[model samples]
Target: MPNLYFCIPKNDAVYFDEHEVTHMKVMRIKEGEIIDATDGNGGKYKVIVKEIGKNEAHGNVLNYEFVAPTDGRLVLFAPSGRWERLRWTIEKAVELGVDEIYVFNNEHASRHYDDKQEKLELIVREASKQCVRYHFPSIRSIEFLDIFSIAPESTYILDFKGRKIPKRISKSVGIIAGPEGGFSKKEIKLLKERFKSVCLGKKILRFETAVILSTGIFAMKLGKI
Candidate 1:
């Protein structure tokens, strides 16, 4: 497969952003070379590089394909913790086909890091490119209680004490993974009241481990993996 890049299409051409231009320079991509690109929506393109300027690269579209969006949404609700661990979780989640991610704060969270939206989005974008994903995932931070606004019936909490994952699930579903220290009693009570819970296994796992494992399992049930 040709190396995949990302661009926004305008008229019959596509313009690569600064990040992509830098990537092209690093890869020694030259004018007239054919490459694959996606708009991070559903459009994929075959393009011939036309020009590489100081800040951006331009290409002429040779062919275009539009992929239909996936059938269901797989949303992940993760707790805020160490930056390195959280970053790894985000990258792995995107590669595993998570549709959206929400990083939240809770009572038992080990540590709190200021939400750097730009850096987080950058990580998501790069992960999408690396995985050659046609549709990129959206991510943001939220408070623990904010989950109430989502469809509680379709949301699940990951806990070792909870029931095993169901063979079937709703088309749109969300999975919530607690922090390193686990959810406080009050938080657990509130969650059990509103959301269903699923167990990955008998053994406990780190927050990031739970996020990735639960995502892969749900994606498999959804036939996305």
Candidate 2:
């Protein structure tokens, strides 16, 4: 994949951040070279390096276009206890075309841990570049209750009783994955009330594994991926 660059929108031009410029310096990029850049809001541009400084980069937009997101928004809800696990799931989901990721604390989830929000953000940014995608996935932590309030076209919970997905889902959908200890009775009861409880298979799987496989399967069934 080509190295994807990012810049902030400024009228007709774009400017790179300190970290992004430093990365280009480390990569030994030179002026007058053409590169692909994204605004992280659907605009992808073909730019020519106009200038490179110690802490910034200036590029001239040669051409640009907006990229429509694939199919529809796919939101993944996962446990927020372990940063590594959360980051892994977030990265894979972003690469596989997830639009947003919501990490929330639940009844069975570990409540004692660092925020690690920076690490999660960095992971999604890097994954977007690596996958050569123009759309950026929004990543944030939320209360477990806020998740259920989202009005998606379809709602699915990762649980034991889920069978093969019956039909292709073509609208906005939410996938909820539980923590290592699984959901509490109240959580399960709530899930049953609001969404279809779905599963990957008979065999047990890790939280990280469950995320990517479920995303890929659903994306495919939706005639995407």
Candidate 3:
């Protein structure tokens, strides 16, 4: 089996930059070796390695293909938290096939997420390659609490206090996972009006874990898992 690698674009061409070039040379992938390439947005191309150099590699395009992107109907609302957990959530959520992951500042969040946007993007890239997923999940900057008002989709809140358990999704879904200490009463009330309050279960779950598990359940319900 060919060892697969992922590449992000620096430009639109057959050539890949320094980092991927190093991998190609180190792995001894010679000219004419069949390699698969993905553009990380549902695009996959089959190419033949034509030239290898110290800092770059060029491939001859053989064929191209793409998977229809998972629609943007599902949006994950991840409350800000520790870097490790945040990265883990992003990776797992991508692998699980969430359409979008939205990190947001919350009342009980312990850490700040202003920085590290680049690092998170890298994690998503690696995770996509590792899981052999064609479409890269969208990761965006942290939004504010009031931002919820702008979304007109069916928002599902993963809280124990939720009155409804989601069984099916007919339209776009906005899933909100609260911070470590959970959402405040005021915040919960604010969200309740914007989203249909739903519970994952009777038991409590950690921030990252809740996002993944609840997403999985929703996916299964929607027949997307």
Worst-scoring 10-residue span by lDDT in model 3: 1-10
Candidate 2 all-Cα RMSD? 2.1
Local distance difference test, per candidate?
0.85, 0.79, 0.72
> How many Å off is the CA of 215 in candidate 2?
0.8
Candidate 2 residue 80 C-alpha distance from true site, Å: 0.5
Q: What stretches of model 1 exceed 4 Å from their correct place?
A: 108-115
**Model 2 clash pairs?**
none
Compared with the true structure, what per-residue lDDT tens digits does model 2 show for residues 76-154?
8877776577767877888788888888878877762337667677778888888887888888777778787863758
- The digit string of per-residue lDDT tens for model 1 on 86-124 reads 889888998889988888888877765445887778888
Clash count list over all predictions: 0, 0, 0
Q: What is the TM-score of each candidate against the true structure?
A: 0.91, 0.90, 0.84
lDDT of 3 by residue, 1-225 (tens): 245556544434467667667667768788889888777777787878877778888786677777786544667777778778888888888777777777888777787666878777777777877787788777776755645753537777787777656556666777887777777788878887777777766776666667777887776665455
Cα deviation at 182, candidate 1, in Å, is 2.1
RMSD of each: 2.0, 2.1, 2.9
Tell me, by lDDT, which candidate is best.
1
